[model samples]
Target: MGVSVARTTVATKTGEVGGTLTNGLRVTLGIPYAAPPFGAARFREPQPAAPWDGVRDGTRFGPVAPQSAELPGAPAWRPGDEDVLTLNVWAPADAPGPLPVLFFLHGGAYTFGSSAQPDHDGAALARAGLVVVSCNYRVGFEGFGHVPGFPDNRGLLDQIAALEWVREHITAFGGDPAQVTLAGQSAGAGAVVCLMSSRRAAGLFRRAIVHSVPDATFSPDLAAGLARLVAEAAGVAPTAEGLLSASPQALVEASDRVVARYAADPDSGPLHYDTVIYGPVLDGALLTADPLDALAAGAGRGVDLLACHTTEEYRLMHQVGTMPPATTEEDLARFAAHWELPADLVDRYRTLMPGAPVLDVYLALAGDGFFAAHTARLAGAHARAGGRTRLSRFDRRRTRPDGTPVRAWHAADTPFALGTLDAAGVDFLTGGPADADDHALSRRMIRAWAAFATGGDPGWEPLDGATGAPVHVWAVPADRQEGPAPAHALWHDVRAVLRL
Candidate 1:
């Protein structure tokens, strides 16, 4: 496949940009949404990019935020690359007027990943009659770690700035800013819901599509404690002045060490299992409460909501050797007690999944407790608060010819939803080559996303003030609208049972 410069030039507030014509879309990459968040601006709010006199080349992606992650097909962070707050755009080359926009945020446990991931290609969605956009924000210590006398949740603030840029400049790229649908998965999904509750992000997007929302917010005290640990590992003071003296790489390495220490300690509490130390901090100004609590109190009632989670979200973590296994009764009991789960939770799971081994049961409980149940509860709370909300679950599963079972786990739904199942390196996520039926399912999911972005129903009923009832299940062969699972009742009071 060959690529050439686009004939059209889009003018933004900062400058004009020239992109490339690929397939049937005008694809632009590396448009700065905010200035470099380092040096004099380190740990402060994002600033506007300096205007350029001529058209800036938008042919390549910008640098990823300072982190240690090296995602396949995505640009990795390197020292001396200061420009990380950039965005990408994709619009149909021949589309006539302004189209609805689908703004996406990439997820990596709020620590890593970038919009430049191959699986995040928005060309398919652009061809589906929408302008697609994705951006990179701060992550890891630079984004979420606490510094004395500085703001928290700077990564989320960067997202808000990106949305502001979209609101002001998307029309030049053939997108209607007022018709934006903010979407994300995992940590990105968590950011979506957090923004929903943030008054600062109010009115920026008309709708939201969140998948696999994680319950990983930190109190001020916890965030401060984590920062102290990272600072100690880096041999720097925990204050803003001292932290600013440390290089981003040093902090990244230090954070990794802290995570390793937690993973090795059996009594390190919840961090021992997940090992992800960064997330949105509960600051009373930007984020006043938990997203679940905020949604229940009608924080984002004005925006439409669509939520989803895979049936076996945590299975991928265990299979990939990232999460520690709870194979024994003692391990399960310790996990339950550490996370403060209700005493009856494991017993309940045993009754629900009779004859299953301890590991399988533990995976089910951990997956639901961490992601699936929270996603369902978010939809329910949004609906009950008088917001237009819809819920779905991904249950696509198959066994390969070599007898490798492909359960719908973790990020398996992304390629399908984004129409990127055939993209490079997607086989690992989709469990190998997709068959014809898998392609058909991908088309259906893509169509559903386009429909929902256009403010229409996604070929299913929306949740109408019901708690986890009537969900659209995405699968091959046929999709179905079904009631909640037998275990849904136990998660109704998730805050009480799954306290992190």
Candidate 2:
């Protein structure tokens, strides 16, 4: 695929926009999916973007949602940049007619991240015979913070609006709207499952791919309580008017303070371990039930689903220093108690991995608790509900030139799935540089994603709901595995005990 820079134009529902041609793909960025979610629209449901008079510039990525963290190769939030609810598109420059569409949502624990991330580049996926779309939705407090007299899950509403835009105008980009596949990672993955259960998002897409869905959601009361913390930290009331009085930057700072406080207090429960302050809120109207319960009840039976999680999902958090170390039995017990795991959970994990360090045991258990288990449960629920589902796990690992080991941690699968292992900042996740085998694994992963988006099958058999067997494990030399992980045998016991 020869790379070139050429102007390309596409007509959208809102207006005509120009994009750049590169690597045999047409890349359009920063097209508004909804009106700027600020000013009169702050903390409310999304509103449609005003139609432009002529061709709009879609050459640059939009500003990210209100966040304090700076990410690699992605735009950061500026105080006055309100046009955050935008979407981007990538399509084969010369598609025969209509191709499958893969709409993506980037993940940063739902508090940070943007579509402009280097690894999120959709050129490779577009070249693989899919029209790729990614969007910048509100994150942090602006997107999830609770306020009286306002709708909850405004970020999800932005996503629904973006999908609606794709359904209405994707044909102009040579995409088959009927074949749209909704895909996301981490918080983005959490949003994917939440949307799957949401009636407001029905018919927006035909398939769903979620990687490492977080085992987290907030009740209305919890959300409101967090909102008050932010409000008090920002020196304002908890009401909508008071919150609106504070700037996005103020709330971002305040949320960081709350996270720091939680991190310092071991008694703060799960938040003390993973201090993300926002997630999908279970409001009675928009989100009435837990996604797991909703899936078990046949909520998304009509959509094809593909789910994957890493073998060592929580390793990245520990490596990045966000998660505190669990070096002692007391530390491990504290973790189990914080997450409401069964009293014997620590002993069970120790039994599963004899001679392992307490930290390793804690990481394994925490990995399952936060990501792997939830992802597996989602597949089981969807399959049991009669949805076509394929389950997979990324188990690739390597030693860097310096002999530092890298496990297949939380997001180690994304660059491979998106065919961007060489993207900037990805080396830290994949370990040093990509070798021949790594590239081959990336190609296979990308193929599975493309195949799944085009058809229902992802080169693997659909999961057998009863046994949940035949999982496709993605590794250097990929292999098919039967039955769940050994530690997973205790998931039922743990979940029953915690009633999660």
Candidate 3:
């Protein structure tokens, strides 16, 4: 009865062990409730795992889902493992019941990242008296291929499986499974939207927080074409038999390269929003309908929602390619030329940001186009759907590569949200702990998230049209507050009425 439960997952269905860490925090590692999703079972709905003979060793993490590029995280390689359909749990080991449950989905554009990264260690969040969970779902074609006979969204299914596991077993670890918050960033955010609309996800969790939902998607034809792209790249014949036999690495590379090529020039490239084919699509199943379409239709009216985006959404993207010599005025003009921006809007931006270089403008434009708008849309849709929505912008920048100060760039808020700032103390997704300024905001966010999970409100002003308070900006008190952004956030109206 005194066995410490450090790791619990769907792998073993339902069981518990506990342990006190050397640092005084309780930890739980790898406990499974679902069967492995490898070999012939791949591309299918998740199945429950078989029970083990004796107490399983959960001191370490389980194998993460299949991903081509391993971001700086979780146990990518593990002994005695293969399939990546596992999840990790961290708690105070013996934290009391009715604790808030926070289920985290790491972001990587649906391509890279695993639950194994140090950036996602939930022990800190758990110490906050909340139950924490991190999961690894299939990525790339293995996770989201619209092939002839394959499931359209393996990644989404993997998420559902993990949440379902939480529903069934989280209580064993002192978590209030009913009061569950499904939170994610980027593609993970997109998955939150999917979960909102999926009937399978109902009752699995109570509230949702979708951070920087990319709103990345494709049309049916485009999705089919992307399948073909994945097939051709994997050296498969677009037939089920062909792809079924393809190597995981080959498929992963094919998908990643295709996405990278298109992401290079999303507006000019094919499958990229205005360009060409890429990202999750509006398949008849899996998603039931496109999130934008569903949101407009009041599809997720019953779900509570909180959404946000970083101030500098494009800076993280700079890692993708080399920015030409720090961006000049001429460079900005060319970018505007390439994207065909409205003349007035370009002029307004030039006037609004006179001190910034052209490259910064372009990057800002990309951020708004890709991340900010989508977040706004999510909040607006939920508002129109008779659901309450709380919105925010993570304003604090990050530490530079050499430990300098960089403005809040893209993906900067993640480290704080996951409580991993120290482990990944870099610009991309790590930094110092909450200072008085950062802590004040993190307190609000953590509470809001917890409140939303328990109920529907995020403890902030509601985002109704009349209030005019579109979002709460996070920062220190004297300088940190919500609302009153640029003209775009003020002028543009995003309603979620049924379109389809």
Candidate 4:
């Protein structure tokens, strides 16, 4: 088919080409910058497309990189067979002067998610007087598999290509390419951290905000094992040929089953580690090391960092309609076997969160393991590395009518953060005004994100240069601030008890 030039400027994010939206804001989606992975391209590092002729159809969102959640034999990966590295953009109409570019990475444990989710509504954010762009890259086996002859982390390369796209073409959309800020939640948050830590990612973005990052780093051996198992399950040769011959449906199905295997373990579920289907790999190339390890060693290359989490980070997972019991002794044993975290941590977590059911303890342990403690450690490390960093905690917790405390769950900040508390897109975790505290706190956080993306300080107390006690309580009314610990931790001295 012939590529036609259109009114909007069609471009690539990283290496994927995207089309533009013809609405109020000059929006763009699904332009390809990389070759499709359907054939020999599978299991190899991403390769740039040789550029297209004519103005491509710079409009509409494209199919995601094959997700197993969509059901077997479904056309999960569609929208033409080529061009998987694409980005969507929303810029003000008749815009004047230089606008800042906000780049977003979608969250799905590095497995399932698309930048086109309505909740991430870039129109509102763009309407707030900024140029917003969301993007897609490879996920699962296609993105993370560690082929014997090829390097891993092809997905991250896709992100780099997208950022490069912003740097090269965002100016055409009325944005200042030099003033780009990378923003994402969950797996996307982990992507932000990866970009910051990568030496290859130097000068790609000026700022970053990561929400509830799920430890994206993995040992090469672990990644290899995951690839081998999944590749074999699909009846493929576990080599480049095997992957190329396997259909996206087969690959996605294998990935979903693997995710199911790890669903019982809360930490494993969020990290996408249980299935080992696909994720960032520490393969000695593209990625040099894990974020925690890299940051401590002063290897983040000095990207300004802003990190935060909801009051109750994991409650959303439980509220999920399909959520399973991610917390059981079986999970702990698996965790112990994997991380070598002394099998006692399973029982220890229970003691710390007394009076709660298995799910609560499961939630707490998963939260701490995935985000809470990491936030603390990352802030201190960034400070020690002489980089600008700030921290915040969403202190909005509500007692449900059922008398169950949902607190600030994983994505509780979205409705509040996007200023769409009653927006129609997400009716699962919440409906109506967030508990009184959430509404007030949401304003603080939303503004905080806007301000931090524009300036270094988030209008809150800077993290301690010494004591490391500077987790800003981001809630309504400055007089009452609280961090990530349980609401009644001081009353029962939860930390002290856990030490036992």
Error of 3 at 273 (Å): 11
Worst 10 residues of 4 by lDDT: 491-500
Instruction: List the lowest-lDDT window of 10 residues for candidate 3.
Output: 491-500
Clash tally for model 3: 39
Per-residue alpha-carbon lDDT of candidate 4 for residues 393-448, written as tens digits (9 for 90 to 100): 66655556778654666766665665556554455545335555556665666667
Report RMSD (Å) for each prediction in the order shown: 1.5, 1.7, 4.7, 6.0
> In angstroms, how far off is 29's CA in candidate 1?
0.4
User: Candidate 1: which stretches are off by over 4 Å?
Assistant: 1-7, 496-500
For TM-score, candidate 3 versus 4, the one ahead is: 3
- Score every model by TM-score: 0.98, 0.97, 0.85, 0.83
> At residue 34, what lDDT does model 2 achieve?
92
lDDT of 1 by residue, 89-205 (tens): 999887888899999999999899999899999988888999999999999999999998899999999999999999999999889999999999999999999999999999999
* Model 3 Cα lDDT, one tens digit per residue, 1-500: 35332333323344444333524345566666567777768667777776666566666676766665545544453323555677777766555557888899988878777777787788767766778888888776777776677767778887898898888887766788778888898888988988887776777877788889875765566667777877887788988888887777677667777655555653442233222233566777767777866876787777778888888777766754533223766655555555445545556766778877777666776677667766776677677777777888888654545987666666777766765556743434434454565655555666666566666676677787444365777664533445644734522543211110
Q: Give me the candidate number with maximum lDDT.
A: 1
**Model 1 lDDT-worst window of ten:** 491-500
- Per residue, candidate 2 scores C-alpha lDDT tens digits across 67-170 of 99888767778888888988999999899999999999999998999999999989888888999999999898999999899998999989999999999999
